[model samples]
Target: MLSTAGRHIISGEHGLFRDQVRKFLAKEALPHLDRWEADGIVDRSFWLACGGAGLLCPSVPEALGGPGLDFSFNAIVAEELAYIGCNAGITLQSDIVCGYIEAFGSEAMQQAWLPSMLSGETITAIAMTEPGTGSDLKAMGTTVRREGDDYVISGAKTYITNGQNADIVIVVAATASEQGRKGLSLILVEATRPGFARGRNLDKIGQHAADTSELFFDEVRVPVSNRLGEEGKGFPCLMAQLPQERLSIAISAQASAQRAFDEALAFTKGRRTFGQPVFDFQNSRFVLAGLASRLQVGWAHLDWAIARHVAGELTAAEASAAKLFHTELLWECCDKALQLHGGAGYMNEYPIARLWRDARVTRIYGGTSEIMLEIIGRSL
Candidate 1:
């Protein structure tokens, strides 16, 4: 049954990859997720294990010590991870941050980072959403001033995924004197560098196992060679890369929705109310039927988006649409699923509670639903 669902959602090499990733997650990740959530961060050993499993940065080319798989393979991993309810931050690290480096980094930078990243010896994070600026990349306060082959960076980034555990961070900062989008640039900052300090591992409402942090850079100097793409080209780089990031979030949302639906279905069937199982109630059946229909649509849309992404045809608006729709649907699914679970859903001991908590941020991060609609509306 799992294989059939896997085949429907993915294909060929990606299907095989999904199977391997699923097996790895079941064996290595699932059991530890609750413990990791309690600890507020996953152990670095798991990253190394995933690297050894060849599950990190599958889209990266073999020259960089990756599997060289396509975006479909990446989607496969995302789907499987979400299916197992693993931390979303880990997926963000292995899939999204690595893509930025692979796409924008120079040959020397790639060679230096890719091997370690692929080996799980190095973890990466993208520091963009600042304490003051959330999605407004142009209004970023982080400044990286040029000083003889090095850029002195001073700023603070909040809500950074993998922030505490990240060995490499791709920082977006303002280099141009002018405001709005043009002045921004992306720089690769090593975590070990002087003046690079990580603040507290933030307490969050959800996804506790995934490390979200606040990072501070005070006079942090990085060589000019660490600049990604070109100086003052960071805005374009960020725009170009956003489709994938949004798509990754959408994929996870879809999988999460499906998981919540499945759990709800099982719960409604097994749970007893008044005098009969909850599934016996017309309201429960109708709610689940509607959610199932939405899930089907969500899956179809996501699959189409994944195909476009694999062909390099996915547009920012389209990706945003997927992110917005699927994530919103995921919230509905979680809410209704929790509702169906009665009071049990509100308790942490139940999986639905965790699912409920985790689903809230889907709408907020990776560009809020409002931001997504604005992007799509502008395109139209």
Candidate 2:
């Protein structure tokens, strides 16, 4: 097991905080996993429980109704949750969405939204990927047309996390259609608006406990004050936030890889073949040895990235590299771990099944491996 006692990046306070999170999950999340997976969404009561535990929006300022903690606290929440195979979207709330609001939201916008978000009474999602636009932000078709002091939104977003449960959505729309990427703006839209609608809760191969959906805006109108940051500056805003967002995914991916390795080790030792433990077989031991070596190196690099991020020294390209490495490591570890389980691994009754399923998407989201390479290649 990876020991926390000597990790320089994690101080005593972070260790204690992790313990509290683990205990909370044991009591509040573990027992409900099966039900949540079946329902395709976690209950709102769980979100309230997280808020009461001070687990949401750890980095938001006290003035904005948050704990005023740093990014390390957010990392603790992500690591603990992912280690246990929980896929709740709490990190999206704390790590990604809160930062955008804190950075660019106006006084009125902050006052109106941050407190409820901190309390978990409000769920937020950022709509970036449009119907045919994959990683190309310049190609999105969503539009925010200004008319008589109201901005009307019209477009659709798919594969959105927190979509089915989002109380408010930060929509990325083209304010000046001819300008391409420069025309995009981030506009906050309430879910209660007349033309706002959520399509079906998407059925996915994994991460069933977290709701992903299709979101539509048919001429949904909001006041001019709803714009976040400067008009036509949304692309840069997203670019600035991508580093930390990618780092968060790396944190979760690293912890999850460790969990997969642990599960495989335990299973191989327990399951016997030819009157001997599977772990005793030469091929099994070799596979595990390779995974173990990679995991040790992965954890070290992850800590370095985390420390760099906490110091505000991690660049977009570096964060992209970390995300690429760790997520790919997660896939390899999960795949090997499941192979060690033989036929039982394919059955949903085993924990490795879910871990394997969840690991597949890590390489695809938070920017794909190909996109990460492009970003890094440009830096080179």
Candidate 3:
């Protein structure tokens, strides 16, 4: 655990909540993580357990059967999950999908979905990335057209999180082709709909436990009421949620980096080389010193961002910058820590190997590091 003074933004209750989360994860998630990774999907039972513990969808209000907490609670779960290297797509559900539905979905939609979601009886995925689209939302090829009282959605989305297990998918498709970004709309499609299909789970280099797959909609139809917000407001709705989504990614990256460093420190101390503990070497100590300094700065900045986020003052640009910096820092720390473990780190038997593998994808998702710089530069 981080030995520094606790985060200023996390209250005593939040700490207690964090402890509750750790205990729940220890009992429910850690034991099955390797099997999930091997299977390329987390079991449905685990989601149910999280729901039973009230660990899913922390920010949804009591009316929706949620704990009625805040984003800090979501961040706590993400941090703990990352520290233990458990990637089960819960953060995507809690931090990203729940926010979109709670903030924009119609009353009937909310009532229909939120309760089961909070109970972990329902799994959700947001379909944004497509075959030919990356970083540019305007390049999307999916289309939704009205036919009487129903809207037919047709397109395929790749790199979708929770694709295999999702009971519902929030699909982003063009409602009007001529309006560019303004034409996009968020349409809720049940996975059991007539033409909806899930492709094979793609083999990934990291986060193997999270089921990432390709989803297809071929004339899949839903009632007009299933549309989120207004017909052409999907772009704005997506933009509003980007800050929290990126912040969630940043929080996970920072925690994972801390875990990698801790693993390296422990390994070095216990390891012997040339009649001395590896940590006794000046080189090892200096490398760890540098990492420690960086982690200290990272924790302080993370707290500042979390505070601003809770106050509704965090900007998309600021969130982008945080994602950029923290994910890069994660890669740097994991790489160096793996090096500190020498040959042992390269072996899958060591936790450092998994840490190193998992650290690479944070820079790519939640807006790539390159996209983050562009967003920040545009703001300046």
Candidate 4:
């Protein structure tokens, strides 16, 4: 009964895992999202539940205590989460942060961290952006001075996702005696360390359920063994992982746009105005028609990019293009959907209002639209 596109999107073992994850989220996550949004953070219990359900770190290898799935499994989870307007933050931790560790972490580091991370006993966050640096990662001020057996880290990172509850943080810092990007190294800092402290949960215009905060490191000492990959290799490591991160953002954006369009369509069909259903109006019909066409094109592009990524053929430019186009289109869809809802869309009680607010951040995070353009332009 599924279309070819649907079948292609969810195939083989991934389809089974996708269905299971959907059911788990519908039952366990959706119900708690409102309360979590009010509290500005999802409870730790949800992370443990996701781990027990085999939803966290599904792509991790069996030797690391994971199900050994691929990135498609993570994409499915992202779609499901966005469909329900839930930014639970667990998906980011499991899908994005876990990839960084699995790909770049040393064998000993992976052995020590992967199992508990897969079990959701350990939460993780990546610190790259500083108060003065975001897309300009090379401008970071965090410094790590190497001692005989340890490295001393002192810096502050702002707008860090999952900062409040992360048990292990992948910190980007400049190694002493080196300059420019060559000095950068990735260090793992345990949250229980004395010098590591989390600032207040940031109050933002959207993504209320996802905890974004400022993190401070005051002379934190980490053993050199905690360094990820080789010294002075952090810049290249970050560059390599960015394509996947961009693709993840694109996946979320596409799903959010589709859900907004669906909600708008159902409302227009049922609501009457000027002695006829809103859908009967020529303006409403034309608007919905345009949105449907755009949605079809956007879905095709996303599916194509996803296929390339899974095949290991996707380029950085292709991933950046997907993120740029989908995020821009998502905001357009949200705004138009809100317009179609008239006064009801402006009310906080409506999901469209929330969707509209949430859509604004997609363009800003995971590398802004402008930064995406710069990356694309350099490829030409």
RMSD of each: 1.4, 1.1, 1.0, 1.8
Error of 2 at 14 (Å): 0.7
lDDT per residue, candidate 3, 127-220, as tens digits? Answer: 9999999788887899999999999999999999999999999999999978878999999999999999999999999889999999999999
Candidate 4, poorest ten consecutive residues by summed lDDT: 1-10
- Candidate no. 2 TM-score: 0.98
**Whole-model lDDT for model 4 versus the true structure?**
0.87
Cα lDDT tens digits, model 4, 1-380, are 11225535667777677678788887888789789989999898888888888888778988776788778888887887887888877667766788888898878888888888877788889998899988876677999988899999999999888999899999988884346787799999999988999999999998899899999999999899999888888889888888888899998898899888988988899899989999999999999999989989888888888889989999999999999999998999999999999999999888899899889999988899999999999999
- Which candidate model has the greater TM-score, 2 or 4? 2
Ranking by lDDT: 3, 2, 1, 4
lDDT of 2 by residue, 1-380 (tens): 33465578888889888889989999999899999999999998899899989999898888777788889999989998898888889999899988899998898999998888888899999899887998999987999889999999999999999999999999998999789999999999999998999999999999999999999999999998999999999999999899999999999999999999999999999999999999999999999999999998998898899889889999999999999999999999999999999999999999999999999999998899999999999999
lDDT of each: 0.88, 0.92, 0.93, 0.87
| lDDT accuracy of residue 309 in candidate 2 | 88
Q: Which clashing pairs does model 2 show?
A: none
User: Which ranges of candidate 3 are over 4 A from the true structure?
Assistant: 2-4
For candidate 1, report its TM-score: 0.97
The list of candidate 1 runs beyond 4 A from truth reads: 1-9
Task: State candidate 3's TM-score.
Answer: 0.98
